[model samples]
Target: MYGYEITQKVKAETNGNLILKEGALYPVLHKLEAQGWLTVEAERVDGRLRKYYKITEAGDKERVNLLQSLQEYLKTMEQLFQPKWSY
Candidate 1:
């Protein structure tokens, strides 16, 4: 999707829990695009030019790796926070 649409969809899905300011989003987009994780293209939409992003094959692998690492981190945190003995 185009940039604004991408931001809107993320905000809607997160229910306002996470908001991406352009300051944060665009740089990441560009960085991912630079890292061969995303293919960026420009198109004319609604009488204006917009850039869209499509995740590349590398991005899929990276996403899986990142999610796995995040899950492991969360599990460690849960174990650390669990009750050590009867209260």
Candidate 2:
């Protein structure tokens, strides 16, 4: 996924449709790049240079970890909210 495209996704899914500003977004991206979890490519689009981000193998593992964690979190919430049947 490209950096801009990811930004769009994050904005669309976030409340108030707020896009992440460089202050937050850039640091995370740089950290991921430094950690080898993401790769970046330079491309010329509309005659302008643009950087695109691609997920690496480490990132795939991370995605799975995050998904599993979220699933467990949801399960915990469900158990807490389940109806009590005690008489």
Top candidate by TM-score? 1
Write down the lDDT of every candidate, Cα atoms only.
Answer: 0.89, 0.85
lDDT of 2 by residue, 3-63 (tens): 6777778888886478777577888999989999899999899999889988999998998
Candidate 1 lDDT over 1-87, as tens digits, reads: 767777899899999898878888889888999999999888887898888899999999999999999999988988999856676
lDDT of 2 at 68: 100
**Superposed Cα RMSD, model 2:** 4.3
TM-score of each: 0.88, 0.70
Regions of candidate 1 where Cα sits further than 4 Å from its true position: 83-87
